[model samples]
Target chain A: MPVLYASLLTLFLILIPGIGIGLFNMKALFGIVVLYGAFLIFISGVIYRVIIWAKSPVPFSIPTVCGQAKSLPWIRQNKIESPHTSWGVIKRMLLEVLFFRSLLRNEKGRLKTGGRLLFYRNLLLWFGGVLFHWSLFIIIIRHLRLFLEPVPSFVEFIYGLDGLFELFTPPLLITDLLILLGIIYLFFRRLFDPQTRYISISTDYFPLMLIFAIVITGLLIRHVQKVDIMGIKAFLIGLFSFNPSLPKESNTIFYIHLFLVATLLSYLPFSKLIHMAGVFFSPTRNLKNSSRMERHINPWDYPVLVHTYEEWEDEFRAAMKDVGLPVEKEN
Target chain B: MVYDKGKVITGLVVFLIILLSPLWYNALSGKVEPSLKLSMPKEEKSCIEERMFMRSNHMDLLIKWRDDAVRKGIRTYKGLDGKVYRISLTGTCLSCHIDKAGFCDRCHGYSGVKTPKCWDCHNIPKEEGSKV
Candidate 1:
């Protein structure tokens, strides 16, 4: 039901821009205004979330360590597994952000007929996640061509590597296929996998469907229903340059693509998709496992009124003597 | 109320740099608004297909021509105007847009696309009349 609702919502989003541009003819509203607003929202929203995380004091060095702690110099320390220093934490974070090191722990154990336990990783989730993320990154880098007027030599180099196979005439990028495949795997898993499905909600399905719609619309603009890209590029140049205008050849599919992407951008900060920024702020992942080595102190510690045990005994001694009760001090 | 102001600011600055990289690059290199002007053949009133269709689907059409002429030995294409023309890149296509550098490579460069393998097999068309 969540999947169905999410799909229907995505369908509606796809139509809104298409019809807004195609039928209603509100190009400026959808293209320039809405998109610019979304960009602003995304920038502020991410910063806001990150600042909030920054303010939330991590009162404990509660890092999740998987290996032996550092003790005797004779014994080898698992620096990566249980980072005790800043450098170790940095390396751990790099591995975590780049390779999804933590997600590797996503495994299941099964008992075989021979009474032996087999523990295998849920490889599809990890693989699909990496593929989808990396593909999306490459695709975004590729889109820098539109925003950047004189596309840098490096971007061109990436373009060449992406289209290394030269599948189509203009050179189809493998990332398009990769992202689609990855998202499909992820989506199917969410819908069908018992554990994932039990936890899956509309939020989970929405992003996947929205991303699917974005990619499909982009593909539509490029391949199936081809629009004059030159005009679109010109329009984008104006957009980036602060000299905004709609192109003569501005097509509906393009508006739809832009709408979906901007929608994702705006939705990102508020949605679960904000794990893009949240991962860096995760205390468990980012914290150093040096609790034993160093004294932990709250940075925001403030002066407070306190009644010490001695002070309490001092105040109560006279009363206790009057009542013949036990007192710490005698006068 | 933010703690670790240095790291948070660094992260935000990095994000901003990447976000505005396009604008920064453009500012450094100057905006490349290459108004691509393809010199139409003098005598022809219109191309085999309309201009917009040619602009968008030229690659599609070119590939179709390559497959038809080389693979299937089908050499003639009936235009939308009902005129039959040779399905040839060099002979039919390049004969009109003779300045491959100007007519083809200009937009391709603007779009950050390489001059694809269409020129790998076929000769880079003569640039004598190129006005780009």
Candidate 2:
């Protein structure tokens, strides 16, 4: 099902740009408005989906356990994974979200000499995944510099930091290259690993392909395609001011890039990519393990009337007598 | 064994069909131009041929400073018209790169910067070819 959805989604993403470009170029105001309206729906839908998930009820405490549960005072406990209190949960969530501590700690076990099991940290996978996510995040934040009028001080700061190692002649972006490499490794792993390959569907391939498309298109526009930067800035400025005028002297790759990006935006909520927001509302990550200390009554449970044991015995007196069984009360 | 073989053959054919269709389409479509037109009026485009053109950059910086002045309206600049233009400088890059996704990508794609979904907020102009 995910494969089918992803395939259709990929096709939609690929097609929308062409259609939107066609509509936009033709000065079809209705088409542009409708397409943009659809875009707005997807963006808002993502937010709504996230909020609904945030407000939804969890019937169980199913946090993935890596450390000890918060229990007896005499025994040491791992507060991060199986947190008992809000603070502990927050700490655990921070580590999980910020550093991917759980993913970092993941290990693959293999049989060793003398039939002993050997657990080895999957550092390469962990590092690759971590690098991909962190760099992706930094890239996202850094790219925000392009949207704002007066680039935020923090954005400039990050840009400065990223460009700190000007090792390459033109100065290479470590995070950018790191993110691209990391995603490539992940894609390769999924394609090559038997386990990942078995479970993988077209959706898995779609994001990778789309993201690679976005990245390559962007790189080409910047370093190779050599677009009219000034004109682009003019158009960006106009858009920020809510007066979007087509920039003069723009490149075609830019259109391709924009089209791919719009597709990603329109598809985010429906895809597993929602995990970015899902982390915050995840019951396992956010919910406290208070079941041991306090009884959690499911809000959905309702009161029901049933016969008491005494009443049941009275009602079934004739049957009980025939069976020669004891009753709750002598009826 | 026959059934398994049939399924395998079916999957291969599907994969080949999926891969070939795009190749066929591209072959038939010729070179797909950007959705937007590239040519501008000669006066506007004269800068394209100039290697050491500073007017665009100068204008960019001037407009940027002008924007800052306007936002930080307390400051004032003497414009070519001789009237004082507001010189507000509360800097925020989002001020200009509003539709980073839409507008910047037009050029950045050529420049090779990874484009993001920055357009959800800022609207991109319809490409000339695809313009409305």
Worst 10 residues of 1 chain B by lDDT: B123-132
Q: After superposition, how far is residue B88 of candidate 2 from its true place, in Å?
A: 34
lDDT of 2 by residue, A300-328 (tens): 56789988877877889989989998766
Candidate 1 residues A239-274, lDDT tens each? 777888866765788888889999999999998999
Q: Kindly give the number of clashing pairs for every candidate.
A: 0, 46
How much lDDT does each candidate structure score?
0.85, 0.60
Q: Pick the candidate with the highest TM-score.
A: 1
Evaluated against the true structure, the overall lDDT of model 1 is: 0.85
* Fnat values, candidates in order: 0.76, 0.00
The DockQ-derived docking category for candidate 1 is medium
Encode model 2's per-residue lDDT on B53-117: one tens digit a residue. Answer: 32223233444465565566545555544656444322222333334345445444433333332
TM-score of chain A of each: 0.91, 0.82
- State the TM-score of the second chain for every model: 0.84, 0.31
